[model samples]
Target: MKRLAGVGVGWRRQLAHTLDTMEGLGFVEVLAEHLDARGPLPEPLVRLRERGVPVVLHAVSLGLGSAEPPSPERLTWLARLAERLDAVCVSEHLAFVRAGGVESGHLLPLQRGEDALEVLAENVRAAEAALPVPLALENVASLFEWPQPSFSEARLLSGVLERTGAWVLLDVANLYANGLNLGTDTRAVLEAVPRERLAYVHVAGGVKHGGLYHDTHAHPVSTGALMLLEELVARLGPVPALLERDDAFPPPDVLVAELDAMRVALARGVARREAA
Candidate 1:
């Protein structure tokens, strides 16, 4: 598969016009749940494809970490959408959003034990078989952790990749949030994953509420997250990285500036790699 490179942003309806005219965008990730496979494609997205900008379908409802297998219908929808758009790949969180007929409405962390890892692997393989393109699993941010985790975050992520042969959608912002809230060693997590398996990176903003850092995509990209992005890029080389903003839509210039900041981080990483 052709790997995504350079800097990009999450494609939302609010940013369609901005992205359509934005220069040097490598690709855009669309939330799969927000689109209907049976309906006509959004004009801006179609235009993006026409311009040779790759589109990656990011699914939120797959619940790949649930004990139950992934829903065939949802997998089918993702496959259909991917084929329709000629997407680069299909990405989803390594999280469970529902269980036992109850929806959590949020991406929840999984138990990083052997049994849970086995279940996650099974679900990922099932989804991979159903999809037309490659699958990339993302690490999510969480406010809490399951007690007595058998595996560290790095070990669990490495295990998933080793077993499923799926790509890693490294979310630097999520890593930062986890580090702040749960005391995760961000660099350790980055060093554990094989650089070759990394598909892309996600950088977003969050705010510190009370005593915890929330991975709220509604805020500005934190400096800590950008630093992590730089570190990852330095280790992995020029992989595709994106800026994500889900709410409190900022002005076009602000988004562009954020993208520019990402570019600067990426450049610094590249320069450091060269120096080393």
Candidate 2:
């Protein structure tokens, strides 16, 4: 598998022109559901590929953490997209989007227990077998967690990696939100993730609404999330990080500033590691 390096941004139609001419752009992640395998490739994306930039395919509806095995048709879509783009890897959330023939339209948290772990592992293995490239599971932020579980978030993630041999896509923003909303020990969870298996990092913006932090990609990246990202970089050493903006698109300069802030955080992390 090819290792992703430097800073990146999620590729959206709104940012196509900016991305096309943006300087020092390392790579871009595209939502897999937004594309059609049989259709013509987006011209800008093709241009990026021509420029030797890596494209990663990220899926949101795989429902890998569901009790049921991943849908074969969804797996096929992911596989075909990866092949179409020669993607560096395919990423999905560690949450279920649907259950019992009903769509939740949200990434619902999983129960942190032996049974849930087993089901997740089985689904992940199915996804791994179907994907053309390496699979990376991302930890999601949820408003509420199950009553009691046998495992912590880090332990559950470790269990999944051990069982499926998949990579980790650490989302710093999600971690920050989870910590704020669910009283999670953010630093402990960060320290527990296996550094060697980390594929990349996700940083996004969110807001505190109704006394809870919501991981909304529409806002500006928060200071707390940036700090968490720096901490992760300090531990892992120059891992690839990407800024994700899904809606309420900001101007190009603002987007560039966010990426710049991320780079600054990365630099701070490197300095801290060196000092240590």
Per residue, candidate 1 scores C-alpha lDDT tens digits across 175-204 of: 999999999988889997687788899999
lDDT of each: 0.92, 0.93
Off by over 4 Å in 1: none
lDDT of 2 at 146: 91
What's the TM-score of every candidate structure? Answer: 0.99, 0.98
Model 2 scores a C-alpha lDDT of 0.93
The digit string of per-residue lDDT tens for model 2 on 103-156 reads 999999999999899999999999999998999999999999999878789888
Please give the range of 10 consecutive residues that has the lowest summed lDDT in model 1.
192-201
